[model samples]
Target chain A: MSKKQTKEITESTIILPEDIKKEYTILNLGPTHPATHGIFQNILKMDGEKIVEAESTVGYIHRAFEKLAERKAYYQITPYTDRLNYCSAPLNNLGWHMAVEKLIGAEIPKRVQYMRVIIMELARIIDHIICNSVIGVDTGALTGFVYMFQQREFVYDIFEEICGARLTTNIGRIGGFERDFSPKVWKKIEQFLKEFPKVLAEFESLFVRNRIFMDRTIGCGAISAEKALSYGFTGPNLRATGIDYDVRVMNPYSSYEDFDFIIPVGTQGDTYDRFMVREEEMKQSLSIIRQALDKMPEGPFHADLPEFYLPEKQDVYSKMEALIYQFKIVMGENDVPVGEIYHAIEAANGELGFYIISDGGRTPYRLHFRRPCFIYYQAYTEMIKGAMLSDAILTMSSLNVIAGELDA
Target chain B: MLISQSVQEKLINEINEHFQDALVKHEVLYDMFTITLKREAVAPLIRHLYNHEEFKFKFLTNLCGLHYPNQKNQELGLMYQLHSFENNYRIRIKTFFPINDPVIATVTDIFNAANWMERQEYDFFGIEFKGHPNLKRILNVDDMTIFPMRKEYPAEDQARKDKNDIMFGR
Candidate 1:
């Protein structure tokens, strides 16, 4: 705020109360509204139906993850990361694991890397399925949402087969996976890959060509490519604006470069394009998972580093050395390298990044989560400032602001 | 992994050519170029990088704050991650100051994305954004008196007993 900038803004964007005659009504949207999909609120000043001014309030679910990460050991922090973007919990878990591994300079085997890629892609697919189906629900198409939601259950079955949990899956360890993908898990993935596309096609046919859905989403909540970039939009939202800035493409991690897939971009960064971009990404994710599974190498599932990785249960029960190693890992006796690092992955929503500074201690000195929802949600008021109320809801759905991620 | 060595050198060269004194420190961490600067130099340097013809680092990819209590005067740091669509390169900028006088110019004037990020930094770390339009807490309660992200907050206070544990269903 310089003097010249203040003068320039006061002359252009500001309107004093005396200059306008109409009274505007303020509508509070949510700290607990169903439409928000999380616990956050917006107070919209409305002139009839058009929003005149908007004020947003977040933090209903702020658990102070960064502060908590400071005190918790690196291994203990994975469960907390699971709760950040709960829809893509495995991705968050893997992303944090990769960040810490990078700090420690721990090398993951090729098989372990491919397994990570499979799980991450599955998580991305589940994320997009929820987002796109929710867009259908927002567009008043209940059939497609119901049809596609069952597909999400299939993916969740895969998660359950891998790790015993569904939602907050503390899936993998710091170095690599806790165990190999069991035969049941492989069968579930195979079933999902075989059966999901037909359901997806049916789901898309229900919404993509429907006149009502197209009308509601095609031109609604539209943002330009430049404005989106300036507002720090990424992932499907940025791609919807025709910027092919996928983190996987830009900075490949976890052997993502080994797989070949296309990054989809949309010409118009509207609600529809956002929906379509995510749908196409889901298809690409399926393709990546196929490639990863086909090229899966044979090796030890978990990294053999006793300093960072937990030993297997059978081995720990049988061997004295494995028992001591397990005890040492569980009790946080491993040495942490003193370093500062940041790692990112193209999450279901956008670019989810973790910035960590370690001081050769069990806990990080400071940890920051670059939750994409937090950054993208900042542009909400600006994008919907002059749009209708319905468009505002559509805009939010398109942006996919998970309250968990936004408040973290 | 990182771009060519030439691109990396040219980027460093451009910054050094313009503001040698503002460049406090620089490093290549995990293949991403990281440059730290004095607190006052951040805004102008980012603005220059955004407008430079060779690298239009137009996107403010991410922004967050950090608190390092042991570092005497440099207790608080603000980090800005930038991306250039033109060149497909990324970099990080960090600036630090004392917690008692944590002040830095706002980049919200340049990128609208900085509005809530700076507010979140203020909410958690109590770092002041000097010229931000609405610099109140964005991710915490309005009347919160203490910044939670600072390292001095006691660890034992985090342990609570009333809630039901998932393991025991207490």
Candidate 2:
């Protein structure tokens, strides 16, 4: 968010003489301005209120998670993935865990699969609520944004019950969950399931049919399905373009095949379609969570790989063998496999892929995170080429470009 | 959807007939078939898959680069993941190059999404995406010379004088 880079980048454009006939005026939309929701800079050439051209610059918050992943052991990298999309940290954690589990060829149980489905669906709901309500807030519907945000807090309460943290949740293990869902946690999820739909219905009642909101969003920042596909969109953004390419449905990982759900898609890839797709997805997510909970199997939560997972506290204290294994696991002394693997999941935003190259060592040789934000953000200048400047903000919010994921 | 036996054989046969000179090997890892080839043949193969009716790899899932220092001349490699929306099958293409001159034909013309991804690859691994439209820098600052993702640089900041290896148990 430094002003230095903004001035440095825009120096050439701003120095033009005012007396000369100029059709467009250059404007720094922001590196530090509000409405971006994160540290981002878009130098826009504006013709009155319309954007003639837009050049986006990211990497303000690039912590280099890929480089960091190379130095850490398999389990140690879980906490780092949490920061990628902080709005839906648990999903990122789950994706990273499943990727490493694929590399290790570990066998996860049915109960663990159901638990992960429930947790990830909750994350998808929370992520969509944020995007949709923020869309309302951006379009001047403050009450609906506030109402949905209040409901989002309840979703956070569910996350807090599942994991200890709220924003950057470092939850789940490689093979499965760190711990099983307790009865109290299940009660909270049940309570959330019962209470959230009313608030969501109230939220929908306020905006879905409203004239002013519809006018502002429809046909604004629209892109064709072909362009969206060429730009490498996935998840809700690509679903808004009427392409049903979900990672879960296409490639079922960890027993996603057992659950029953429908993939919601929208006809036009505009702000309205993206918002409505997210709205319908929240309902589908509710159905998935209900199915997962109703048929929740009973078994061990974590996988049976003692070399990867730490032993129970009771066993670690009582048995010397358990203590030795736990010590070796923590210190990165375990034998990892030698192979090249690519694993992806439908993250809250899109397809988040982790490409790992292992040389039979404790640490990965090369770990590249195919971050969706980094790919889709490239198409921003094209999306907002000739649209109004305000619609640029709408398109960005609808796309849900997390800075952590964008710059990782 | 699961890369059926006949489709896999057809893909291999097509590559064997046309791109035999550039083909290195093909193996299945994590249940997805990965085809390794020479670096120069990547863009041509990507174009072929998109245009051919039998393959229909219309959507590019991802494009990234990696460095393996142990492989003497083949230190840098690029990986492309393509997905067909209709058939619901996936294929991965990997190509290796020498670190001293890591260059590959750009696929920006075939897949417009490759523009920034190639720039990111260039920014991190220093792999030149020849013929890229605006291949400058996407993520990192423009003035940076060193490719920070290579094995030469340490993960932690070397300027951190206060940190100790004892704290990290190194």
Candidate 3:
């Protein structure tokens, strides 16, 4: 192969007449704007109120997660998973762990699987509430935003009770949760279940049927199913296009096949449809969580594999064998099985996939994350074209563009 | 559906008839059959797959690179995962390259999704994809000095220290 140097264009002249018939304005929706949600820069070309062209630039928060995963041990990547989509950390955690577990053929207990389902559903509800509420807030609806945030605060309280951390809740370990859910935690969840529906109803009443919200979102940024699929859109964005393809239904990792729930799809595939899809999804997620809790099985919470799963803390304190196993695991002394596996889960945003390749070492040989935000960002320009500038913000917010996952 | 032995036999025969000695080896692993070919024979074989009625891999699922540090015959592996929604079947095509020089042709024209995936692979593993439209550093910054995904790249702390020292004139 030969290298060729291409010529670069420098400082092209733009001629504007004093008596211009038409005018176009460039709006820089910042790496700091409230509507951006994260560090994102969109150069919007606007003619009057309609957007002509939009260019999206990410990487303001790129931590090089793929590169980091290659150097870290398989078990050590869990915390890093929390940072991918901070809104839905458990899904990323489970995705990465399930990929590694598949590669090594680790058999987790049924109880552990149910626990994972519950936590993942909770995370999904948290993400949907925040995303939907933020969309409402961006559209100048303050009541719905406050109601949803109050509900999210309740959900975050539950997370804090389960794990020490709230936002970056690195809740689960490799094979199972860091600790079993206490009885108080179950009671708190039960209380949340009883109270959340009323708040959701309040939110829906405020924004779902409001004439102003409906007028702004009904036909704005409409995308066809064919165009969405062609652009590789997944999750709610794809579901809004009338496709009932959820990874939990299609692939069924973490024993999601055992749970029964409906995948809510949309008709018009517009901003309203996207918002409605997420709203219906929150209800479905709550139902799934309830079912998971009701059908919670009785068994070991973690896998039985001593080498992979961490031994009990009591055993680590008492038994020499357990202590040695703990040291081996913590010190990266155990050898990881060699193989490749791709595990995907229905994340709050979309299909969060972790493709792991092991070379029989403590660290992974290669790791790749199939981030849904990247594809959504790719389709952003097309989605926002010909829409009003405000509709661009509405569409982006409904899409729940997470820059951490986008620029990872 | 389980892949029938007759189908595998037919595929092998068809590949052998078309490519002659250019085909290296083909094998099935983990319920997926992979066909290995020479670098020059890739485009023709891909075209054959695309056109053949029985094997219409219309969707390019993913394209990834694998590096083997001390492998003798094949040091670097480029794997393409293709899905045929029409046939409800999938196939992986892999080609090998020497460790020192890993070059593969870009299949962006076949499927546009491969464009970003190939760029990502190139960004990390340093595998050059010839004919790629916008072959620039995607995930990393444009002026990144090292390919961070390579096994030879330094750890995070060492790399950070090196950069700091260089910037501060140590």
Output the number of the lDDT-best candidate.
2
lDDT of 1 by residue, A319-349 (tens): 9999998888888767698887888898888
lDDT of candidate 3?
0.80
lDDT per residue as tens, model 3, A140-214: 987888877887888788888888778888787777777889898899888888888899898999888899999
Candidate 3, superposed: residue stretches over 4 Å from native: A1-23, B1-60, B71-76, B83-91, B98-103, B157-170
- Model 2: runs farther than 4 Å from truth? A1-20, B157-170
lDDT against the true structure, each candidate: 0.87, 0.87, 0.80
* Residue A356 CA displacement from its true place in model 3, Å: 1.0
Q: Give DockQ per model, in order.
A: 0.59, 0.68, 0.33
Evaluated at residue A28, the lDDT of candidate 1 is: 95
**TM-scores of the models, in the given order?**
0.92, 0.93, 0.87
Candidate 2 — which pairs collide? none
Model 2 lDDT, residue A159, Cα: 77
Better of 1 and 2 by DockQ: 2
Query: What digit string (tens of lDDT, one per residue) describes model 2 on residues A78-107?
Result: 889988888898898989888888889889
DockQ of 1: 0.59
